[model samples]
Target: MTINRHCPTCRSRQDFRKLNDDEKAWVRAEGSRSYVDNLWRCTAVGCLTYFRIGRINDRGLLPEKFKKEPPADAERP
Candidate 1:
Protein backbone atom coordinates (compact mmCIF):
# COMPACT_ATOMS: atom_id res chain seq x y z
CA MET A 1 0.00 0.00 0.00
CA THR A 2 1.28 3.43 -0.92
CA ILE A 3 1.46 5.47 2.23
CA ASN A 4 1.04 9.23 1.97
CA ARG A 5 1.25 11.51 4.99
CA HIS A 6 -1.23 13.83 3.34
CA CYS A 7 -4.97 13.30 3.66
CA PRO A 8 -5.92 10.88 0.91
CA THR A 9 -9.54 10.68 1.99
CA CYS A 10 -10.28 14.39 1.84
CA ARG A 11 -7.64 14.88 -0.85
CA SER A 12 -6.69 17.94 1.16
CA ARG A 13 -3.21 18.68 2.35
CA GLN A 14 -4.66 20.26 5.46
CA ASP A 15 -5.40 17.85 8.30
CA PHE A 16 -6.70 19.21 11.57
CA ARG A 17 -5.12 18.69 14.99
CA LYS A 18 -6.76 17.44 18.17
CA LEU A 19 -6.29 17.98 21.91
CA ASN A 20 -8.33 15.95 24.34
CA ASP A 21 -7.44 18.07 27.34
CA ASP A 22 -10.55 17.06 29.26
CA GLU A 23 -10.00 13.36 28.62
CA LYS A 24 -6.23 13.58 28.96
CA ALA A 25 -6.41 15.07 32.42
CA TRP A 26 -8.42 12.08 33.57
CA VAL A 27 -6.05 9.60 31.89
CA ARG A 28 -2.95 9.98 34.10
CA ALA A 29 -0.72 12.36 36.03
CA GLU A 30 2.08 12.23 33.46
CA GLY A 31 -0.50 13.03 30.81
CA SER A 32 -1.08 16.66 31.55
CA ARG A 33 -2.35 19.62 29.48
CA SER A 34 1.01 19.71 27.70
CA TYR A 35 0.11 16.38 26.11
CA VAL A 36 -1.94 18.04 23.39
CA ASP A 37 -1.65 16.20 20.08
CA ASN A 38 -2.31 16.25 16.37
CA LEU A 39 -4.59 13.87 14.45
CA TRP A 40 -4.31 12.71 10.85
CA ARG A 41 -6.84 11.99 8.15
CA CYS A 42 -7.22 8.50 6.70
CA THR A 43 -5.02 7.64 3.73
CA ALA A 44 -7.95 6.04 1.90
CA VAL A 45 -9.67 7.97 -0.82
CA GLY A 46 -13.12 9.30 0.10
CA CYS A 47 -12.93 7.71 3.55
CA LEU A 48 -12.57 10.98 5.50
CA THR A 49 -11.45 9.14 8.62
CA TYR A 50 -9.35 11.23 11.02
CA PHE A 51 -7.47 9.72 13.96
CA ARG A 52 -4.75 10.43 16.50
CA ILE A 53 -1.42 8.60 16.89
CA GLY A 54 -2.59 7.22 20.21
CA ARG A 55 -5.68 5.90 18.47
CA ILE A 56 -3.71 3.38 16.47
CA ASN A 57 -2.94 0.39 18.70
CA ASP A 58 -2.07 -2.40 16.30
CA ARG A 59 -0.02 -4.01 19.12
CA GLY A 60 -3.15 -4.30 21.29
CA LEU A 61 -1.45 -2.35 24.09
CA LEU A 62 -4.73 -0.60 24.80
CA PRO A 63 -6.53 -1.70 27.95
CA GLU A 64 -9.48 -2.64 25.73
CA LYS A 65 -9.68 -3.06 22.00
CA PHE A 66 -10.99 0.10 20.40
CA LYS A 67 -12.48 -1.88 17.56
CA LYS A 68 -15.60 -3.96 17.82
CA GLU A 69 -15.22 -7.74 17.77
CA PRO A 70 -16.74 -9.81 14.98
CA PRO A 71 -19.72 -11.91 15.90
CA ALA A 72 -18.90 -15.62 16.21
CA ASP A 73 -22.07 -16.59 14.36
CA ALA A 74 -21.61 -14.05 11.57
CA GLU A 75 -22.59 -15.64 8.26
CA ARG A 76 -22.17 -14.64 4.65
CA PRO A 77 -25.29 -13.18 3.17
Candidate 2:
Protein backbone atom coordinates (compact mmCIF):
# COMPACT_ATOMS: atom_id res chain seq x y z
CA MET A 1 0.00 0.00 0.00
CA THR A 2 1.09 3.54 -0.81
CA ILE A 3 1.11 6.35 1.70
CA ASN A 4 -0.34 9.49 0.17
CA ARG A 5 -0.54 13.00 1.54
CA HIS A 6 -1.50 16.41 0.25
CA CYS A 7 1.30 18.38 -1.34
CA PRO A 8 2.14 21.54 0.55
CA THR A 9 2.92 23.35 -2.66
CA CYS A 10 0.19 22.08 -4.97
CA ARG A 11 -2.53 21.17 -2.46
CA SER A 12 -3.10 17.92 -4.26
CA ARG A 13 -3.10 14.40 -2.83
CA GLN A 14 0.13 12.75 -3.89
CA ASP A 15 1.86 9.47 -3.29
CA PHE A 16 5.36 9.77 -1.91
CA ARG A 17 8.62 8.08 -2.76
CA LYS A 18 10.35 6.67 0.34
CA LEU A 19 13.62 8.23 1.34
CA ASN A 20 16.85 6.26 1.18
CA ASP A 21 18.62 4.80 4.18
CA ASP A 22 20.92 7.75 4.64
CA GLU A 23 18.05 10.17 4.60
CA LYS A 24 16.03 8.11 7.04
CA ALA A 25 18.98 7.85 9.39
CA TRP A 26 19.49 11.59 9.26
CA VAL A 27 15.91 12.25 10.22
CA ARG A 28 15.99 9.72 13.03
CA ALA A 29 19.10 11.33 14.43
CA GLU A 30 17.43 14.73 14.47
CA GLY A 31 14.39 13.65 16.46
CA SER A 32 13.62 12.16 19.85
CA ARG A 33 11.90 8.92 20.83
CA SER A 34 10.92 6.70 17.90
CA TYR A 35 9.38 9.62 16.10
CA VAL A 36 11.57 9.35 13.04
CA ASP A 37 10.63 11.84 10.35
CA ASN A 38 10.52 10.39 6.87
CA LEU A 39 11.15 12.57 3.87
CA TRP A 40 8.83 12.30 0.93
CA ARG A 41 8.51 13.97 -2.43
CA CYS A 42 5.21 14.95 -4.03
CA THR A 43 4.39 12.71 -6.99
CA ALA A 44 1.67 14.82 -8.55
CA VAL A 45 2.25 16.16 -12.06
CA GLY A 46 4.32 19.34 -12.04
CA CYS A 47 4.25 19.44 -8.26
CA LEU A 48 7.48 17.91 -7.18
CA THR A 49 7.91 19.19 -3.63
CA TYR A 50 9.35 17.68 -0.48
CA PHE A 51 7.79 17.31 2.94
CA ARG A 52 8.08 15.24 6.11
CA ILE A 53 5.78 12.73 7.78
CA GLY A 54 6.24 11.05 11.13
CA ARG A 55 6.31 7.32 11.74
CA ILE A 56 3.96 5.99 14.40
CA ASN A 57 4.12 2.86 16.58
CA ASP A 58 6.39 1.18 14.01
CA ARG A 59 3.28 0.62 11.95
CA GLY A 60 3.56 3.30 9.25
CA LEU A 61 3.88 6.96 8.47
CA LEU A 62 0.87 9.11 9.25
CA PRO A 63 -0.21 11.47 6.49
CA GLU A 64 -2.14 13.82 8.77
CA LYS A 65 1.08 15.07 10.28
CA PHE A 66 2.28 16.14 6.88
CA LYS A 67 -0.45 18.70 6.34
CA LYS A 68 0.61 22.24 6.96
CA GLU A 69 -1.08 25.58 6.81
CA PRO A 70 0.65 27.71 4.22
CA PRO A 71 2.51 30.67 5.59
CA ALA A 72 0.62 33.91 5.07
CA ASP A 73 3.66 35.51 3.43
CA ALA A 74 4.32 32.60 1.12
CA GLU A 75 3.26 32.38 -2.49
CA ARG A 76 0.95 29.55 -3.55
CA PRO A 77 2.15 27.04 -6.10
> What TM-score would every model get versus the actual structure?
0.25, 0.40
Candidate 2, poorest ten consecutive residues by summed lDDT: 55-64
lDDT of 2 by residue, 1-77 (tens): 35787666665667877655654565566563244345565555444355556532223232433434556666655
Q: Which 10 residues in a row give candidate 1 its minimum summed lDDT?
A: 58-67
Candidate 1 stretches with Cα past 4 Å from truth are: 1-37, 57-77
Expressed as tens digits, the lDDT of each residue in 1-77 for candidate 1 is 22344443345554333324543343344343243334333433234344454454311111121222455676446
What's every prediction's RMSD, in angstroms? 10.0, 9.1
Best by lDDT: 2
Error of 2 at 5 (Å): 0.7
C-alpha positional error of residue 35 in candidate 1 after TM-score superposition, expressed in Å: 9.6
Candidate 1: pairs in clash: none
Highest TM-score: give the candidate number.
Answer: 2
